[model samples]
Target: MEKNIQTKYWVVDGKEPDPGIIRQAGEIIRNGGLVAFPTETVYGLGASALDDNAVEGIFRAKGRPQDNPLIVHVADMDRVWELVSGVPARAAGLMEKFWPGPLTVILRDGGVAAKKVTAGLDTLALRMPDHPVALALIRAAGVPVAAPSANLSGRPSPTTAEHVRNDLSGRLDAILDGGPAGLGVESTVVDLSGETPVLLRPGGITPGQIESVTGRILLDPSLEPGAVIPGKPRSPGMKYRHYAPAAPLVLVEGTPSRVTGIVRQMLEENLLRGKRVGVLCREENAGLYPGAAVVGAGAGGEPGETASKLYAALRRLDQLGVDLILAEGVEPRGVGLAVANRLRRAAGKIINTGQLHE
Candidate 1:
C-alpha cells in the first residue's frame, strides 16, 4: 500500500470550527487518510480503527511500534460495545462516572473491530474525548478512530495544533486546527479487563477518583525494568518510555530550598563537564541557578496552568539543543499528580530532596 502522502493543513478555531473544515477532516478519515486533531488530553493523530490499512498508516506516520496499541476515540457510549465484544461491569461503572472526560477504559474481547485498533490485543483502550473538536470529528466521520499522540513515537505528546504541524507537517494527510489542548496530557488509562480494576496510567483523573466512583480498589502495576508479561497489556502507558524529549532530563523533587540546591549542583556539574544546562521551573527559582537558561511558565502553586504548559515547555527546551533539563516537581495533589506523573516520565533521573530541605 502506497503511503497516503497528501500533506495539507486546515486551520480552524475550536470556538467555531468551520463546517467545511470539519467535513473535510471527516472525509479524510473516511477515505483512509490520517487526520491529526486535538483531544482535551492531547492532539491525536487518528485513522479509522475499523480499517486495517488505515490503522497501519497511523503506525507508519508516527513511527510507532506495532505492539504499542492505540486508543479508540468514540462519540458515545452505545458505540463502545460495538468495538468491544463484552464491556465489563466495572468498566460500565467507570463509564457512567468518567466518560466524556479524561478516563480511558481497557476492556476484554474488544472484537475484531477493536483488534485492528489495539494492534490485535484481546483488550481495547476506549475513551469518549471531552474536546468539542475531537467529538465533532468522530461523530462526523461515523467511525471509531484509533489515535495516538500526534508526535514522533516516544517524543513529547503534542497539546496544540501548531505542535502537531511542527512534528507531523510533512508526514500527515491533514491537521484540524483546534485550539490548545485543555488537559495538556494524555488520558487517565484504567484497565477493567480483570476481576480487579487497575489504573494503568495516571492523568487528569486519579485512582482515588476512580475508587470513589466504582467502590473498588484500583491497583497500580508493580513494574520493574525489563519485565515482560505473557498476555496482552491491560494498560496503555505501561511498558514504554513515553513523553520523552530530545535532550536528557533530570527531575528535581523536594521542598523549594532542597530542589534549588540540587538544581545548582547539577548545573555546576554540567558546567564542569562543559555542557549547556536548561531549567524548567517557575520564575522565582530563576535566581537559584543564575548561569543557567531558565524557562518559567508562571509563578508556582497552579498545577492546572503548569499542566497546560508542560508539553510545550518540554518541546521548546528540546528545540534549544540543551544538553540537559532540570525540572521542578509540583505537589502531587489534584491536577498536580498528572503534572508530576508526566514530569517523572520525561525525566531520566529523579532527585528527591524532601529530607535534605528539612
Candidate 2:
C-alpha cells in the first residue's frame, strides 16, 4: 500500500544535518518512503532493504529495472553479516581495508534482504557507505538501506544534493542535502559469490588497487561496451546506456593534442550544421575550440581531479542547453580509468585516435 508522502525539501547547514531532521527522514524510510542521501561516492536513493514495498518505491521513483538489483548499505562492519550468509576471505580483507568507504561486494543473501531488493537473486550486493550523513541515517533508521545512484536511471549519477533535487524532486519523499559527494563516483562492485572474485563495475576504487590486496582479480566482461542488453545488467552501470546527459555527447579519445584536434573538427562540423556545441576537455585545451562552449575536465596537476569534476561538468553542459557535447577522454589509469569509463558511456559515439585499444 502506498502512503501519502508529502515531499519535503530541507537545506541543512554544515556536514552534519540536524538530529531531528535526520530522524524524520529515517522515520520516512521506516514507513516505506524514499529518501536520497549523500554517500562518499555519490548520493544514493535509499529505501529499507528489508521492506519489499519500501524497496519497490526506489525502482518506481528512479524508473530502474527490478532485475538490475540494488546495493544494500549498512552503517557498521558488524552489520554486514546480517545481510549476507558469509563474507569470503578476500572480500573480508577488502571490507576491512575499504569498508566505510566506496566498495560494494556481492555475497550470498542471508534471506533477510527483500526479494525486490535483490530482484529475487540468491546473491545480494552490499556496502557500508563512507559518508557521515549516510551513516547517521542508517543508524537512526536501524535498517539496512538498499540504494542506487540518486539520479534518473541511465542518466549521469547525482554528485550533489541539488543534483538529486533536479532529477528527482517531486518523485520522492525527501533528499538529505549534505553538500557534494567526495569521491564523486559510485562504489566499486565486486562479485565474491562466484568461485573467482570479479569486478562487476569500476568506480572510486580501481582494478589495480583491488588487485594489490587480493592478488589477480577478474574484470567482468559485462562492463565492456556493447556487452550487455539494457535492463539486464548484473550490476549498475554494466548496461550500455548510463551516466548520459540530455545533449548528444561524442567522446574523443587519443593524446591530448589528437583529442583536441578531433574535437575541433567535430565542433566545426556541428557548427556548419548550425548546431550549438559544447567542448568538455582539460583546462589546457579549452582554448582549442574558440566558438564552442569549453569546460575543463579538471585541473591538470591534481590527481583524481578529473574524476571529481566529470559529472559536474556534464551537468553544467545540460544547464547551458547545448545541442552537442564533445568530451575529451582522460588517461585510462587510477581514478582516471573510472572517469574515462563514464565518459565512454555518456558519449553516443567514440572516435578513438589512439594506436592502442582500451
- The whole-model lDDT of each prediction reads 0.80, 0.83
**Candidate 2 on 1-358: residue-level lDDT in tens?**
2334566887664367799989998998888888999888888999998999888888888888677889999988777887789988999999888888888899898998898987767898989988888988998888999999999888889989889988888878998888888888788898889888898878888888898778888987775644645455667777647899899999887776777778888899999999989999888778889889888877654437877778888999998989999988777667776777788778898888984233
Give candidate 2's error at residue 178 in angstroms. 0.9
| lDDT string, candidate 1, 231-346, tens digits | 55555556666688888889888787788778888899998898988899976777777777678755677777888888988898887888898888777666776777777766
Clashing pairs in 1: none
Displacement of residue 156 (Cα, Å) in model 2 is 1.2
Models 1 onward score TM values of 0.92, 0.94
Please give the distance, in angstroms, between residue 154's alpha carbon in candidate 1 and its true position after superposition. Answer: 1.2
lDDT winner: 2
lDDT (C-alpha) at residue 86 in model 2: 93
Q: List candidate 2 stretches off by more than 4 Å.
A: 1-5, 229-231, 300-303, 356-358
